[model samples]
Target: MQATRVLLELAGNVVLLLWGLHMVQSGLTRALGGDLRRILGAGLRNRWTAFLSGMGITMLLQSSTATGLMATGFTANGLVSLMPALAVMLGANVGSTLIVQVLAFDVTHVAPVLLLGGFLAFRRGGRTRSRDLGRVAIGLGLMLLSLHLLVATIAPAENAPMLRRMLGMLTADPVVAVLLAAILSWAAHSSVAAILLIASLAGGGVIGPEAAVAMVAGANLGSAINPIVEGPGGDGHNPAARRLPVGNLVNRIAGCLIVLPLLGPITAGLQTLSPDATRLAANFHLAFNLAMAALFIGPLPWFARVLTRLFPERVAVADPGMPLYLDRSALRVPHLAIANAAREALRMADAVDSMLRGALDVLHSDDRKRVQEIRRMDDVLDRLHDAIKHYLTQINVEDLDERDARRVSDVLTFTINLEHVGDIVDRNLMEAASKKIRRKLRFSTEGAAEIAGMLERLSETQRLAAAVFVSGDIRSARALMREKEVIRDLETSATEAHFARLRAGRTESVETSALHLDILRDLRRINAHLVAAAYPVLDQSGELLPSRLKHGATHG
Candidate 1:
């Protein structure tokens, strides 16, 4: 009964620790997610800048795991090079230990005040920012309260015979002690919590100095495990995001290993700094991570090169839509301006088609960097959209003949379709890709092939539509309009096929149902945009219908 009671009390405290960490993570995310990402983005210009950025953000977030995940996303997006990103992660490790240093001090007196103030602010807050701040305060209070509870619970264990024997066994085998602490920290998903438990145990005389030091080493290594295991790299969440956490884990493990054999000296050194066992553990945690950052800061480039070889960039289809023909000086001449707009419109078409061709690659590949690189090309489409819009607006319609006036209208309509195609690709299609990569999802082979076939047809039809936009070719315009129907039918067929696969108990189909349908729908949208580009040329030629049915036609 006593053992059961003690176990339950320890479990409850651990849960409280996790709950507090969750509150803090979510609260800060809501308040500063975008701004922090932007900061990290701007700071990745070099190793020094990236390291400082990592340190500053982790200090604010108080979680190296969170910073590592964010940096992974940036690397996946090609915003940060591997070397600088690795440097940022080094600083984040030091920053994470700072939380332990702060939490080790006696702060339970403020828990009640923080809880009350946070609850009121959260309840009465108008802005989302205020509410998020309230959540942070609440998290802080819970953490302090949990710590106080832990200390109280462990105090009674000092005189317990069974507890002392267990502590003695751990003290006898420092490696076992280290491994147990690592497991405890990994399970808790917060090294701070694990360290706090060790500190509390040590302060109560349930653990000695050497045992505490070994456990701290394990706890440090264990902290690295949470991000690596939970991070996108291991779960297939995203290979691009995996590098930061994996590199971090390697660094932590190396540091822990180097210090593990020398626990006696390290503990003695720490004892000189602080006689209190809790403060020693906290000081050791901070000092070890600081040493890691210092040791690896200069060699970050070499470390990055090692990770790059381990997680090399996947081969992706080269994007072929660079708009070199968009001459700014040509805009003053109406004819040259129209010609430039047409050329830019063709570039947009090429981009849309290139994105469509890569759609299947997004579905089947394990390479997250490749997936993000493809998505990043959509920025070019936005630039082309703006350039074409401005260039077309500069043309004088009054100076154009009736034929050329109609061409201007056709070109403008074509540019809008081009822009829509880019949006669907970047927003809809890429979002689905990110979801799949993040979730480690895949489509069934048959379903994947079905979507692939439709995208290819759409890409060809889009190319023809682009040609028709510039040449005003009636036959090609008619063909594009017809292919629009093909895409619509393909979407319907894929939807039905997906359901059939789901009914047959296909795991891939069930897992990727949302992804498959979304990609199909997005392709149909792209086809619609391409088809619309054909309408103006067809209408001017007297070959376009207002709808599928004539005015007097009867419904089936």
Candidate 2:
């Protein structure tokens, strides 16, 4: 009856510990919000910065797995380089040891005070900081309370013949103990929980020094499971996604092998320095992670090469059906979502440019094959436009700041213009092709040359527009607007020349002239949208917009 009561108490303590860890992790994630991504994005400029960012983020969140997963997502999205992500993962491992250190301290007396303060703060406060503080207090209190419960329950178990026999069996084979610990930790999905269990057993004399050390090592190896499983795999065909999990697996497996042999000496040396078995186990956990990181840091570049060789990058298909910017997970971080939207807009610009080029190809050649290729290109642009619209609708659901809202608005407007560009190219140009194929409608020599030249200028302008949007270059934006005005003037002049040719009976088809005018109109509208897309970025940067210049406005 006493043993049954003790087991129940131990089980309750474990539940409290798990709940506290969950609350802390949840609160930290909510408090940091999208800032985590921005910090990581800006900080991954070099290997050292990435490492530091990883450690800082993990320390703040109290979860190395979260930091590593975020890094993996960024790498998969091509936002950060692979080497920097690996560096960050290494740093996260080091930072996660801080939790174990905190758990090792004797703070049971302060548990009630922490719980009371945390509950009060959580109930009264509305701000993120207050909530975060409450979470920290709750986590600390529960950890201490659990330790108290564990010590109380397991202290009596030390003298039990059955418990002693079980402990002896575990100690008889350290390898089996290590394997058992690893399996339990993996099953629990919480290394901290596993470590806490070891700490509690060691504190109550339920497990010996060597057994505790083995368990600690095993828990370290088990912690890698979450990262490997949660990594990118929906598109496993993508080489980078496959490499991420493989690299993490190799790192953990190598760390385990190196530590397995040293476990006996490590525990002995620590025990000689400090008689406290729990302290020795905690130190062993810290030393193992730090030592493994130091050992692997130098060989990271070589590891990256090996990962790349094992999973070479596959070529991305130029299929317009793929929406480059519309990753559902991106909504969790609004800044990344905005960046992705801008990238998609640039792609839309390119699609429009391709459609225009296809039209020009049809104008230049009477060949049926060239005309058919243009039709295919038009289909591609149409698909891209549909995708952009759907992506924008999804992104709209995320709570965006003022600047991001304006950017989203600009992208939506730009997509509409690009869609119209596709329409003109597909409808008007295809109609002309059909007429030429069926009725053998032909343009005079001057008409053909003039139309081809105008189409070439239009395609060049589209290319520049895409470049300006992608690079976020103010100079390029201004140049695009100026070139657009030139295209407008050239279209006007070309229309007059074609009218003269029609009046003098030099051209047989007035319909071709009208189609040329319609194409120019659509091109002008597309350029206007491109200019609008650049406006918000320029305005945000304090660059004068064309409207501001036209109004003769100056900031005070």
Write down the lDDT that model 2 would get: 0.71
Point to the candidate with the largest lDDT: 1
Model 1 ranges off by over 4 Å: 234-241, 316-556
Please report how far candidate 2 places residue 348 from its true position, in Å. 4.1
Range of the 10 consecutive residues with the lowest summed lDDT in candidate 1: 547-556
Compute each candidate's TM-score over C-alphas.
0.60, 0.65
* Pairs that collide, model 1: none
Model 2, span 129-160: residue lDDT tens: 68667877887788788878787778888657
